[model samples]
Target: MKIALDAMGGDFAPQAAVDGAVLAAQQLAGKARIVLIGQEDAVRPLLEKHGAAAAELELVPASQIIEMGEHPAKAYQQKQDSSIAVGYRMLHTGEVEAFCSAGNTGAMLVGAMFSVKPVPGVMRPAIANFVPKLHGGLGILLDVGANAECKPEMLEQFGELGSLYAQYVLGIDKPKVGLMNLGEEEGKGTSITQAAHQLLKVNPHIHFIGNIEGRDLFNDKADVIVCDGYTGNVMLKMAESIYDIMADKKMQDPFFDKFNYEAVGGSPILGINDNAIIGHGVSTPLAICNMLLQGYQMAHSGISDQIKNTFKS
Candidate 1:
């Protein structure tokens, strides 16, 4: 398998990206190949500093770097030669099996959707992240900022996607699915959530677990959580912030550190044709390395093939 890395897409670009790539290459020596995409000159020195060689790895030059502050769409369009854009291009063209980027979230999503396109029958690709629950495990949240405004059908589809992810990545035989809402009753949330809840409950492909309130998310209420991008994104950010606040207090919170997006790695952009893991701009070496391994795993996980079969109906 070939994994593409955005060597200059994050705040710690070139250095962090290079270091992470080296780590991944060493860890998965025979399992996968690394392709560093960015300013080769700058990245090459970092590779040497780590006492590693990228001779077997491909260096795809990207003349531009997308700034975190730039508008995602605008940056991707204007900076055609950027690492994010170039890496995505490789993914779309099948030159690489997966593309990993610790760049602007918006830019990364934009590149995946526009560059590689969504899977067949997939209306919109969703961003799914893993959050550790208080019950000593983790829950996967979908549509975490992709489509803020979603129809009931979209939410149901997110449920399907999240289920596949949980089953395959989390090793759950039958992951429980939950709809984010105000209450656990049948008619609890707004029309959208209510409609989504009903649809997911009837969807035989998933193990629907009924409604889950925000307060119950970390209580081990469900293994997979589905919400519209707007709500999911807000919840993800808020949850991360609370954890960070606690960590700042230097509290003995194992959950806060283990489940952090940066620590567990980044979120995957589901429904894309190829493996594309999106990371925050502030990702560090460990986070990037984790994302790199995730890229390798998903690329060969038969996810795209499964999605094709699922959409065939």
Candidate 2:
């Protein structure tokens, strides 16, 4: 298998990306290879700096770049030769098994929609993030920033998508799916959550644990938390802020340390037909390495096929 990375996508650009890819290449030496898509002039030099360690990695030239602040749809359409665009084309053509990028979150999401597209039954692809469980593992949170406002059916699909990811990629068995709401009762939130709760309850694909409050986020209550992108994004940012505060104050714990974004590397765009991940703009070499490893795991676990099979039925 092959994993592709946008060497020009992040704040640190080719240096961090090249360093990360080299690390991932070493770890995935026998299993898979790394493919870097970016401007040859900028990326090739970095790869050369690593000597023989980066020799095995392939570089695909891309002359343009989609800036972080540019409009996602417009930039993606106009910058066809950009690193992100080229990476998506490679993924769509089966030239690579997975594509990962730390630059332009909106561009990554847009590429997922227009390039490889979403699974047939999916209403909209969701950006799913990892949540550290206080007990011992990680949980999945969907619509982290994909669709700010989602229909009831879309929320229902997020549940199914997150559940499948947990089962296949995270190695969770019969993952408990929960709707993120103001309360745990059957009647809670607005019309959207109520309707979604009803749909999830009757849906045979997931193990719906009903509504979950924000307080239950780090608990073992649910392995998959489903919500509209607005709510999920707010919560995610809040969690990150708390981690930053703790870090600044020199307070640390095993569970609290898990809140660092570097630990998870990037968020996976679920419901897309192909494997793609969007990483934080400030990702370090370690974070980039972990993101590529995650891309590999997503492709290898066959999560996309599992989702297609589930929704097809």
Candidate 3:
């Protein structure tokens, strides 16, 4: 497995990326191939500082970096030499099996959509997060800030994608899926939510569990939850903040330790033709290593192949 690392993409840049790559290399040993993409001069010393075998890793030079505030489309167009672009380019060409980055997520998303593009018949890609529940279960949320606005069809597709992910990745067979809504009642949401709910009920591919309110997210009533980008993103941020506050209070909660967003590594960008996982900017060496492993898992999961066969245009 050839894993590409955007060495200059995160807040800590080359140091953290190199450290994470080194950690992953140490853990996997000869099991995986890691390619670091960035300014070689700067990245090499970091690897050397850690006493890592430089020859065991490949170096791909990138001439520039993309900042968080930059527009992804504009940056990709203007800065062709950016590390994020170069990393995705390699993934698109199949030189690397997966690309991992903690850089500007918007740019990464844009480059991925325009470069490798989404699978045929995939209307739009969604970001999926693994949320840990109290009773030792994982709750998967889809379309988390990947698309601010979604159609009825998009929501239905998210349900399908989220279900497949829960089954294969989370090891949940026939996982119960619920739509995020204002209330548990059938007609509690806007026209779009109502239509999506009606459509999801008949979706043969998903085990729809009716509507789930935000308050019920922690109750472990559903394994996989579906919502538009707007609602999903807001919920994720709010949940994260609450978790942080609890942690700051020094509560001895194992659930909080296990379910932390950063602790889980990264969110997989589903529906893209290539394997791409985005980590938080503040991700540490451990997070990066885990994200690398996730990229490899998703790359070889066969979920993409199943999606292609099922949704061929």
User: RMSD per prediction, one decimal?
Assistant: 1.5, 0.7, 1.6
Task: Residues 1-313, candidate 1: write the lDDT tens digits.
Answer: 7999999978888888887788778877888899999987898777767653565566789989998889999999999999999999899888999899988889998998888989889888899988787867678899999898999999999999988888876777799999999988999988999899889999989999999988877777788999999998899889888878877888766766765666667799998888899877788888888898888878767777677678769
Whose lDDT is higher: candidate 2's or candidate 3's?
2
Tell me how far the alpha carbon of residue 281 in candidate 2 is from the true structure, in angstroms, after superposition.
0.7
Measured against the true structure, the TM-scores of the candidates, in listed sequence, are 0.95, 0.99, 0.95
**Candidate 1 ranges beyond 4 A from true positions:** 53-56
Give the C-alpha lDDT of model 3: 0.85
Q: Model 1 scores what on Cα lDDT?
A: 0.86
Model 3 TM-score relative to the real fold? 0.95
**Count of clashes, each model:** 0, 0, 0
Q: Compared with the true structure, what per-residue lDDT tens digits does model 3 show for residues 201-293?
A: 998888999999987776778888889999889888988888888888987578778757667788888888878889988888888888887
C-alpha local distance difference test of each model: 0.86, 0.95, 0.85
Worst 10-residue stretch by lDDT in candidate 3?
A: 47-56
How do the residues 103-157 of candidate 2 rate in per-residue lDDT, one tens digit apiece?
A: 9999999999999999998999999999999998999999998999999999999
Rate residue 53 of model 3 by lDDT.
61
TM-score of 2: 0.99
